[model samples]
Structure formats: structure tokens, C-alpha cells
Target: MSPDVTAFGPDFPFGYDKWLGHPAGLGTIPAEKHGAKVAVIGAGMAGIVAGYELMRMGLHPVFYEPGRIGGRLRSEPFTGQTDIVAELGGMRFPTSSRAFYHYVKKLGLETRPFPNPLTEAAGSTVIEIEGQKHYAERLEDLPPLYREVAEAYDAALEEGARFSDLKAAIAARDVARIKEIWDPLVDAWDERTFYDFVVSSEAFRKLSFHHREVFGQVGFGTGGWDSDFPNSMLEILRVNLTELDDNQRFIVGGADQVPKGLWAHAPAGPMHWSPGTSLKTLNAGAPRPGAARLFREGERIGVTDVWGHTELYDAAVVTCQSWLLTTAIDTEEALFSPKLWMALDRTRYMQSSKTFVMTDRAFWRNRDAEGREVMSMTLTDRLTRGTYLLDQGEGRPGVMCLTYSWMTDALKMLPLPVEKRVALALSALEKIYPDVDIRSHIIGDPITVSWEADPNFLGAFKGALPGHYRYNHRMYRHFMQGEMPRHERGVFLAGDDVSWTPGWVEGAVSTALNAVWGVMRHLGGRTERVNPGPGDMWDELGPVRLGE
Candidate 1:
């Protein structure tokens, strides 16, 4: 029997590894350029994937990370606890993010369906707003008012955006069709906020402000998307159409394992190094010091480490957050155009906070007097906002993400310590399940994170405001700098923030690959007959810039 290729999906989208293995994908560089060194900043998934692929193409990529290799793919396990964790950063990923799954499958990693509200894995859900509680196993179980609002949302998506058609076009890689559908929407919604899109729509107009408020508090997929209300409609569409908010799964151990695995993985072929040599071995098991400054000297780009040591590299891919260029690092003004710098400076990020706890077991699984789990994956208008439960199985320790909030909600918990945050979350949760003593089941100290408090990352991820597409277009296309004037050819940007879908790992991985393509060209290489990079399909697949 033929192998099941279903996980790869039906449209047979861009084959990342297949493209690499193809003859057309091979030998992009001149023989003399083999093993030439390139600088890769940030050891996140983007940097790691780019470095890994560059190594396969016979280039040596030295990575520099200020902290750990995972970047925002951080999974914090409780102290002395195994099989339980708090996902402090990017957690769930959709299957449609194929490029990301390619690495996951290659590393022999396991994944389980994320317990998103209303999904089968979610079991049940509780949506509480204004002191009224509604429990359901499905959307239909909600009050008629909510059902009307849900129907309106579905209708609006169909009539206003042609959502299903757009999703299909993207799935098929029918770039022309995608552009045909997406371009007009960008023109229509680029200057509008998600809230504007909803209120102005025929469906939402008929609904009451209270209905709108309920929808804002407990959205269908992963609690409220209201944090995204202030962002451009185009941003929301990119997320929804690409399935970033649906059919998701969590990496079995930890999401960070993906990048960590790639760092140590040894490719098989003429990599110009030993057969079993890996990035870990090549870097001598340590990353270069964090870069404190970057500037163009004579021909190559000069990078200064935090220790004030400076070195020059032929090319550099900066996967760090854009704000660092101005705030955390001293980058030469001449490296990027004034326009590009403006875009980087204008990039806005959303603040996010999460509080998680380790429990002895899946205590929530314990049946109540009514013969149901005491609690469900929760969504509420209260301070806690959203809560998710994770089961490690019958006997192993389980984890509960007590609260996940963004923007104003996140800022509220910023000043509090971890214990206080956990206490506040429990106090709020107790109101919903008054009979249950949530604090009693805890097995270890709670873990909490306020991304805005972290110096390395000023915020969680980019949350593009209305009229921000031009800025995004500039940043996303920074990899095309080889085509720019001589002064702007070396420094390239790649990260989730620079991608169209911020906070999604697929964006990070895809944009990183885009940077790899750019770096190859910068190093005097070109794609062969069939394995063309994103630039080759630029006209069809390029982002829809505002006022284009």
C-alpha cells in the first residue's frame, strides 16, 4: 500500500524539504564559496531553521543568542516536576502550518490536539459574562442570543471576506487566485480595525452591544480575540484564513524542543563538513556572544558582541525583534533606508501574561455530584479571561494554564509577583466553580510570565494597527535587500514580527527560509531550474502592500 501522505495535506503545497532535495535546489553557490561563514542572529526557530538549511547548502552559519536557543518557544517545566509544563510563549500550531510540521515530523516529535474551547479535545466549555454562566459541549448549547451572534459572525465572514474561498486558494497555492481574492480585501480593510469590521457588518449591527461584548470575551477558538480588535482587519484575515487559530496541537514535551533539535541535527550529504557534524559541533557547543551593535564598515557587515569584541561577516540575518535595532543595539543608520527604519520603528507589539500551575494529576477529571468534570476549558469576562487544562494522562502530573491575557488585561498583572498572580487567578476561578478547591490539588509552585517585563523581548508579538500594512510590507520584504542599493545588501530581517502572521511559528520558520534564500543570493548564489525561492514567485505570492 502507498504511504499515507494525508498529514502533508491534499493540495501538495510547497515541499520545503523536497525542494531542498531536488536537483534544481542543489548547487546554488560557486565551488569557491563553499563553507563561507554567515552570521545568524537569534537562536529561535527562525534562526535555527535558516542556519540548518544554510548548512545543508554548504554554508557555515554561526548563531548568536543573548539568552537561550528557543527564544519565544519557551516551555517552562515546574521545578522538580516532569511531564508537566507551563507554555510561556508560542504554544499551539495549526496543521496548515506545513513548513513548521516538516521539522516536527523530522525530529520524531509527538503532538496532541490543543484543548481549544468547543473543540472535541476541549471536552466542555464554560462561558461566563456579567454573572451569567452557560455550560456547553458545543456552540449550539449556548443561549439563543449567543447562537445568533455566532451565526452573524459566520455570515459576515462569508459575505464580507469570502473566507472559505480565500482559505481554499491559499491551500491550493493558487497564488493568482489568492491575490485576486486577498488584494481587494486588503484595500477594503487595510485602514480598518477588526472591531470596525465587526460593527459595520450587517450581522453585528443587528446585535446588541452586550452581544458584542460577549463575543469579545469568549471567542470561538481560543477565548477572546478582542485583544486583536485594535489591529487591522487584514491581520485577522491572514490569521484566520491560514488556520492559525484552528485545528491546533501542542508539541508533546515542549515546543522549544523543535529549535533545540534543529540546532543539534546533523544533515546527510556534502555539507563541506564531517558526515556527522552538527551546528552544535560546528559552534563548539556554544553560541557567539549576543550582538550589541551592527554597522557596515568597508565591504562586509561589522557586528560587535556584548563584550565589545567586533567581527566582520559577509552577510547577516537578524532574527531578533525589530525594536532591538534601536533600543537594545546600536545599528548604523546607513545599513537600512530611512523608509525601512521607519517601518521597523513603527512596528507595534502586544503585551501578554500567562499564569500556570502544576497539579498532582488531572484533578479536573474527577467527577462531580452531577457526574461531570468540575471545570472545563474556561472563558469569562472576569479578570482571569481564559483558562486551559492539560492532562498528561491518568497517573502523571497535569498542567493547568490558569490565565492567559493580553493588552490591558496583561498590564493589570504586571506588578504582581508569581504567587500573587496565581492567587488572583484561583480567586477568580473559584467564583465559577465555588464547590471546587483549586488550590488543594497544586503540586508545585506556579509559573508566570509577563512578556513586557522581559528585556530581551519588549512584548509578546507584533499586533499591527490599522494603516500598518505598509510597515509590515517593508519589514517582510527586507530579505530582498540584495536588489537594494549596495549599502543595504547585507543585513536581513527574519522573525515572527517581520512575517505576515505574527506570533505564529510558521511565520517565523517561513520568513527564516525567505532569509536563507536572500542570504544565498547575497553570497552570489541562485536557484536552479526548478527550485525557485519565494522571490521567484514574488508577483503572485508577495504581500498586498497598502495603496499598492
Candidate 2:
């Protein structure tokens, strides 16, 4: 009921006539030409949002998803009741993601206020010592030296309400309050991702006691620290490791269910999905039979495949792994060079392991003393690559828990056989939740995502490196073009990687919305689309640029 008119305000779906053009069951019907037929590659949020925009313009879109519809926007329904709806990809976001809010509301979907979980938990901070982890009520328990500096530094950082998140607690001397609001590092989408946040943040400079917890590198003091990782890599590690944000909301079932609902409601059009398929090449020069540019066709880009397999399209888009986009051919000058690709590789990524341990629910379901959902316990690990929980929708129990979401600077070096990657995940879990009855508890690990080992994605995402603020600005400017603030269209690129707000659902949504708006404006007759204010962080800093 609520989504019927998302951005339409108060109540929506006002008049379908105002929104739909052309004819009924006919956005897909070909008529004249508006110039070029758009081709969106990669099926993730960026690609999907682009496709959705094209269809809304009375033009058809041939959504090309080399894999399933959702990219990192996926779920593992295998363990069914046990798997706990593990979202191995983009997690949740806050009201800060304006486009997401508009999109959800415009679609007229049900909306619920997400109750913050950190409320009930007695612990909001954790520290790691010599690989061992422990939680704390106040950061005071840390070594006297760090406790002195960090506390002093933490004392100064303020969150003005106008600043997206206000830090009244810092002024009020409320440890619990600050825990709920402040992030040690800035959240910016830059080529430097998390790598840039660390060395640059004010908090890290003051607090060095829990360096591992703050920088999150596996074996930091070890040989893994190389002259190679001087700037971006080390900086990203520091920022992401120490940065934190907890504003939250989620759909009823698994997160993917929300997108599925969107698709089910989309006006009829050409939607293609081939999960096991891989894009061999992007035949740009050598012409194939039929549509020379099926990728930009009406609705059926009848473009031929590697072996002369042809297909049609009204507007075709490739929504496969982004690395594939860069690695489409065997030529040296294909998309990006191997060194460039290798440089891309050294960027950053997220790795996770989830074991949906189904327990006799209803037990942990009780609202705590303060009317909050009880969180059994949360143990922080210095080496938890990249991990967190996806609050399943109403009525669904069990934790969609996670582990080890990190910028894989060190991991890329390890030679992981498929079995080893799987084993590493289990081992990491064993360390986190030692109480689980290994054989009986885990129902055969229904799902595991070792992006490093997966040849397709190379790595899940690219973390923001040092000085990413500059790089991000350049990317967004170069790609989103319009008469507005920051609009770069022609080279439209969207992904968690491109969005300096790396390793989270927020960036993905951020990337998609901008791209969607750009596509719409290109076909929005003559009305220019506005660059949705850089939501939050508008005045704080511009997109990270490379050379200052």
C-alpha cells in the first residue's frame, strides 16, 4: 500500500495515464527512433536500474544478464529454513540513499521503520589483542595510552543534524549515544574506497591501540605489508577497518525479495536471464550477421554470439560480472590492460562466509528490557574479512549472519583451491561461533561466496583507496553528464566498485539511481534530470579525484 506512490508524495498511483505513454502492453512495441538503442551491461543494480529506466521511457529494453537477474543482489535459498536468507551481497542502507527511497516509494511498496538492534546490545565497541577479540561497554578499557588519545579525539567529533547524522552524544558525553551515531571515517565513493578513509580520518590518528580492529588487515605486522601498499591500499584498510555506521531498514523476506517484487510489477518488456552463460567477447569492430549493433536495438538486439549465435534487441544491456566487461577479448587493447586490470585487482573487495544456524527461535525473539529485539551476542574479530547480519523480514527467524568482509590486499596472494576457500570460510566461522555443534548445527553449508576464488567476479567490490575522494569525483563527473551539478552520462558506469561508497548496499543504490536518472533524462523528452544532491556528504567533500 505504501509503495503505490513512493516519490509521488502523500498518496500515489494518482493517474497511470500521466506516467505511461505510447499504449498498454506496448512500451515494447517498436515505432519510430529516438536515435540510439541503449545497451546496459552487467545485471546488478546498475544494469537493472538502467533497463528499468529505458522501459519507462516508452522504449523497450533487452535486459542482458549473463547470469541470474540479481548480481551481488542475490540470496542462498538452498538451506531453505536453515540458510537464514544469507545476503552474500549488498546489505542495507539508511534514509540517506534518496533515490532508493524515491524508487521504493514510487513503486508503492510497503515500508516499515527498522528498529535499531544496537539498542539492546550492552556492547557497541570491540577490540582485538594479539588475534583475540573482546567486546567493551566503554572504549576506556583499552590500553591507557590509546584510551587517553582516542577518548580525547572521540570527544571532539560532532554530528550536526544537518550533517546527515548528528553527534549530540559527543557533546553530551554519552558513549552509548555516540556508538549509535558516529563513524570514525567518512563514507565517500572514490577509486580509493576504504583505503583512503583510514589514514585521512581524525579518529584513527588518536586511537592506535586496536590497530587491527581499526585497519582490518590479516597479519598486518607480517610480511604482507609491502612497499607496494604504501598509499591507497594501506589507507583504505585503515578507514574501512575503523569506520562504522548502523542506521538500518529491511524488507519482510530476504533482501532480494524486494527486487523480485519490483520485477513482477514492471510493465511487460524483453527481460533476458541466462545464469550459466558467460560473455566471450564484445564484438565491437568485426561485424556479425543481422544487427551489427543488436546491443542497441529496439527491444531484441539480435546480436550474434561467439559461434554465430544471433539475437535481436530493442535496447540490449550486458549485466554480467564487470571484470568480464574489461576482459571481454583476448587482445591486449581489449577494454583495459592486464596491468590496469591488475591495478584494478589490487583495489579492494568484500569476502564473506555465512552459516545460517537455525535454532529453536522464539527464544531469542523476546524484546529486551527496553522493548528492543534481543541480539544474542556479537563477537568482533580482527580478521572477519567482511561480515554482518541481514535482518530477515517479519516472521522470519534465525540470523542471516556474516563474516570476513574485507579489502583483499593480502588474500589475493593466497592460492585457494575451491575446497580451500570453502574450508577457510568454515574455519573462520568456527573461530567466531565456537558453540555451534559443527556437524549438527550447520546444515552442510548451503551457500559460500569466495569471490577471490570465483573466476567470474574476480573480487566482489573495489574499496576506496587513499585520495579516492578525487578519483570518485572524476569518475562521476566523466560518466554523468547533464546541465546539473555532477552529471556524467556517456560513459555511464555503476557498481559497488565505481561508487567510492564501496562494500555496501548504499553505494550500489547510489550508483544505480544516478545512472537511471541519466538514462531517463536522455529520453525524458527535453526535461533535464537533476543530479540528486550528493544526498549526504554534499559539502563535506567532493568525489575523490586522483591528482588532487
Candidate 3:
């Protein structure tokens, strides 16, 4: 059962990639149910993916979106530049996200290794802490303190989570071994914080407070994870075990293309629709207005758009941030059990802000007097937590993500305008590279996004807190509705927030596939014998349940 290091769950280890790639074609719906209308709320990645699959299965999926199509996979182009754009959200896609890559390949989209901190793709990295800066092309180039911190984290993993053995089981797709090791971890770490894990570890206990602080700032994989210090250790462990933060890449043109492509693409051979039928054509080109209300109207689900146009459907798939269910939409109380509602309402979303500027050229690639890059990928403790340089090409204008910050750091810029945000970021970077003038190279109106400020998205994505494993478990497995009361059967939840690995696009895609299965099954459809869907394997491979 050796599979790719995919999003195959440390929780629900269902191979969504396998189900998608199978020749069986995601199962078949009864001919009678072919044209059944299924309301898909939110036109984000999860919504678009679920809508696309349901459309292929012969069901008519009506989309409702408050904002743009891509959702969190936003690629905001600089003024007057299409190809050169800023990835506002969900920018980095790890190689382990096999399910997500499946669509990237399907759309023939080009991807390049994301310039992560210390990765060769970044060319070079600069770590700055407390007004002290250290430049390095690799880990070894830094001082011994950096190496010791790295080694301490590695040792801590081996000590705390059986890192090596669990990762091996995951890569091997050994479901039994994965559960045997990971299930118990749910109970052990679900109540603890990531900060607690490091402080409690023998490796970090021996090191000074500075080492732990360094580990949080210039953390492994992307950048500072200090924002996630208060999050559950189980969340961080899932990321480590699945390699969600390693070997990442970004779509060449824009990540927005993936969801837009899925929306416009005509599957090779769809179920009941004509050969040229697509989600774009089915709903008369654009999606309905944002879903303002969700309720069950006499066995069928009803979704009322903002414009007051209500539509009834046999089933509905909700892919928006869970908070919307309570805040934005008037979701009927009877639609879900009290426990499920608590999970949905209590789900915590983290704040994130990214400010990107289009440069006149790839001037950062220029060398300084010391023959080093003038400006390298930066990780600092300043207001700008992480800064990435996006080199378009030698002659082409480059997109510079001047600052990417999360949680408290993100909230700092939430109230500031784009100009102020850019100015603040420049002020911070000026201290690190005093000689290089970043503002001088700026070419276009700088773009920025504080996801929390956007009414459509309350926050960037879910960041599970301690003791919230039960909440996550309830939401992630809500797709399996066999035993649920009939009143709650018609509507299903799908989104990154509804998954164990929130904030990762892979989780969004995986959960959407689950909702597709749930919708299919609700519509009286079943997968072929050769390819069992997630629902079909639920009892055998569901996520480990934590006792109350």
C-alpha cells in the first residue's frame, strides 16, 4: 500500500488522489438523479472543485459566491500586469499535495519551486533578529546556534512524536501503522500547544530561551511559526508528518487559474450533460449572489441568495469559512445537531496579511559589495515577519511579497491602508538592508490583503486550538452522514476549515472530494467496486475518535 506522501490522512487516511485518478471516474449517479440541483455555496477552491465533480457526475451544481472565484487562492495582479501578479493567499503548494497537483496537471499549469527560506529556490536567505542580521545560502553557512536549533527540533520530533517511524508509515500508506501511531497522538497532544511541545521537550529544555525563540522565528519549512505557538501540537505534527510545509511550489501565472480552470473546464466525458457542458455554461456563466441563508424546506435544502432569489436543491455543499454559517448566513438550527453546531461555531480562524509590490526588475538579484544578493528572502522579528522575492525573469518585472505575516502580526496591518502597510514593511526592511532601496524599484500600485478585514472571509483559515481535536474530527467526518438524523442529511460541509490540515490547499481539495462523495451518495449514487470512495471506506479508515 505504498502511496505518495500525499494528504492521505494522519486522521482519515483516505487516498483522495487514488479515488480521483481511478478509471471508475468518481462513481455514477442514477440516471434519474442526473439533473438534480445541488446548491454549492462559495465559489472558492473547495466550492469550485465540489461543483466541478458533481457536474461531472450528472448533477446540476448551482454556485453561490460573495467574492471572486478563487477564494483563498487569490492572485492579485499589479495594476496593468496580468502574468506578473501577487499571490495573496494559499501561495505555496507542497509536493506532498498530490490531490492538488492532479488538477494542476489537468489544467496544464506550470509551477516552479516556491522560494522558501533556506531553500535553493530562494537563492539565498537572510535571518534577522533583534537588529542582528545573518546572511546564508544554506543552513551550514549560519552560526552553530542555527544548526543547534535545527538539530534540537529534529531531536524533539524523534523524542516527542516518533517522527521518523510515523513519516515512514505515511509514505508507505500503511493505514494500520499510521493509525496505530497517530490515533494515540490525538489524545496526547490535542490538549497541548505547539509552544508547550517545544518547552516540554528534553532537547529544547537543555537549550537557552533564545534557541526556542529562534526556532519560532526562523522556523523550519516556510518561515516563522511563532504565530502558531498557541495552536494545538496535533496541528503542527500533522503538518510535519505529512510534509505539508516541504518541497513546495507555486503556479507560474496565478493560483487563481486552478479554480477558474475547474470552473470553465469541460471534463473529457461528463455523465449526463452534453460533451461541451461545463460549470460555466450550466449556471448561465456566473455564479448566483452570495448565499445569505441556508435552511431545510420540507426534506429539501433551500439557499437564498443576497439578491433575495431563493433556490431549492436536493442537496447543498457549503465550502465557505465555517464562521459564515453563524455570522453571515442564517443557517437553520435544526439542520445540524447541537454538537455539530458547536464545532462549526467554535472553529477558530487565524488572521493573515500579505503585501506585495511589483518591482521595475529583478534588482534583488544584483550583488552587493561583498558579492552577495542585495536583498534575499528575509525572516525577521519585525512587523514584517517574512518577506519573499518573486523573480519573474531577468528582464521581466518581479513581484515582491514585501511582507507575509500571520495572527497578531497580521492584525497590526489590518487597520492600515496599503500605502501605510508598504511603508511600514519598507521601514523594517531598511534596517536589514540599509543600502538597498526597495521603494525605489517599485513599479506599480502595491497590492495587499488582510483576509480578516474582508467580510467575505472572516480570517485567512482555521488554526485549530488546544482541545479542539474533537471539533475538527466532527467537521472533517461530517461528510459521512449515514447515521445522522435525516434533518441534517441534505447539507454537507467542505472547506479547509472543515479539514484536519487547515490553511493548506490540499485540505481544501481533499474535503471537497469528500463532499462530492457525500453529495453523490445523498443523491443515490455509489462508486464502482474497483474504486471505493472515502465514504465507502469510512468505518474501516475514519479518523480516530477522541472521548469526551
**Each candidate: what lDDT?**
0.83, 0.40, 0.92
* Clashing pairs counted in every model: 0, 71, 0
lDDT of 1 by residue, 1-548 (tens): 01112112111134454554466554376668788888888999999988888888888888888989899999888979654679899889888777788889989999999999988888888888888988888989888988887787887788789977777766555656766887788778889999998888898888899878877888777679788899998888777676777788999889999998999998777457779878898789978889899998787988898999888888898999999999988999999999999999999999999999998888887777877778899999888999999988878888999999999999999999999999899999999999988888998789999999988899999999999888888888888774698988888899999988889888888788888888888888888766777766565456665654
Residue-wise C-alpha lDDT for candidate 3, range 273-365, written one tens digit per residue: 999899999989999999999999898999999999988999999999988888899999999899999999899889999999999998989
Better of 1 and 3 by lDDT: 3
Question: Per-residue lDDT of 430-477 in model 2, one digit per residue for the tens?
Answer: 564464433343343345466655555666666444544444444443
Our model 1 lands, by Cα RMSD against the true structure, at 3.0
Provide TM-scores for the models: 0.95, 0.60, 0.99
Q: Any idea how many clashes model 2 has?
A: 71
Ranking by TM-score: 3, 1, 2
- Of candidate 2, the 10-residue stretch with the lowest lDDT total is 7-16
Question: On TM-score, who's better, 2 or 3?
Answer: 3
lDDT: which is higher, 2 or 3?
3
lDDT for position 7 in model 2: 17
Q: Enumerate residue pairs that collide in model 3.
A: none
